[model samples]
Target chain A: MNFDKELDARGMNCPLPILKTKKSLTDMVSGQVLKVISTDCGSVKDMQAFADQTGNTLVSQTEENGEYIFFMQKK
Target chain B: MKKMAIIATKGTLDMAYPPFILASTAAALGYEVQVFFTFYGLQLLRKDLSSVMISPLANPAMPMPVPMPVMVQMLPGMESMATMMMKQKLKKHGVASLQELRDLCLEAEVKFVACQMTVDLFEFDKSEFIDNIEYGGAATFLGFAGDTDICLFV
Candidate 1:
């Protein structure tokens, strides 16, 4: 799916992936999608928690080749 | 978003990290987070602060990735060496630097409370900290923590 912004947090750890996603989401209008790619296993839980708390939508997420891909929509 | 309050009490590298990490994450999660620094924690608020020291004397939690005798940790220069190793490990894991964590906390609007009593007792130069840090006593911090879902002392 197409996204409004893409953040490559490939090597970053838990908090960075989520924190960067949040910083990006702030400028996004409601309904805009953000694509985040991360290698850190902990990002999965962190992003999920972040989305759940911040009222953002964790539209979809999948992992391939050890990299977790998350598509979140700004709420 | 509800409120979260963290009391940071130590200046060591290991001790300083928990508040920064937890408070920043809480703020990012849409919570109003407040971190109150008292005692040794005031060092982290200094404007020219560098990396913190590791208290190896009794820190069993300190990771020695390579197998080493516990007594070896007490050798001269070992504390600094351990601190340096910790910094490198943190870097290798892509963990944000201490300074970056602090900046992120502030950017997320995490309220930073500096204890006025400690400030006066230690004679800390008030000019050493960045602006936007609120100076308060126990009453003020407890006021913010009054109804928070999470209240932590780190």
Candidate 2:
């Protein structure tokens, strides 16, 4: 999928991945997409919660070789 | 915007993680968040965190390398050892340190209010805490907490 930025949150635990995602989204303009790669299993739910609470769009989420990949668009 | 008020009442290293983590995340979610540090919880606002060690004796759920009886956990150096092990595990899991998490909360504009009564009761010097935080009594915090959508006492 097309993305304007990429955040590698692999190996980072709970709040770190969400925190970094929030910070990254802040730097982008509305409608821009961000690709986040995380290894923390909990991030699967966290990213969804973050997207729901923040009003960002989680365009797609997929898993491959234990890595959770997410595409989120700024609101 | 939604608002959140958290009363932090624990001081140990393990207990410290919840308030900061939740505050920062809530702030990031565009909520106006405030954490009120009272009693022993005020230790989290101190400039030096050397005293914020965890005690295994208080936490039976803590996983240990071996089965540790209550008597063993009560040893003089057990607290320090447990704290060190927890710190290592946190680092290995890429969890932010308490100091780092607190800083993130501050950067996210999560208000930190230290309980003035606790400071007086505990005889803690005001200068011992980090700058850029507010000192107030329960009423001062309630002024905000009373109307907030989320109120938590951790």
Q: Per-residue CA lDDT of candidate 1, range A1-75, in tens?
A: 999999999989867888889889889899999999999999888888888788899999999999999999999
Q: C-alpha displacement of B109 in model 1, angstroms?
A: 1.4
DockQ of all candidate complexes: 0.81, 0.89
How large is the interface RMSD of candidate 2? 0.7
TM-score of 2: 0.97
Two-chain DockQ for model 2: 0.89
Each prediction's TM-score against the native?
0.94, 0.97
Clashing residue pairs in candidate 1 (N, C-alpha, C atoms within 3 angstroms): none
Point out the worst 10-residue segment of candidate 1 chain B by lDDT: B48-57
Give the TM-score (0 to 1) of chain B in model 1.
Answer: 0.90
Question: Highest lDDT, which number?
Answer: 2
- In candidate 1, what are the lDDT values of residues B1-154, reduced to their tens digit? 6989999999988788899989888888888999999999998898765647885667766667776676887789887888888889889989988899999999998999999999999998999887899999999998889989999998
Could you tell me how far off, in angstroms, the CA of residue B31 lies in candidate 2 after the best superposition? 0.6
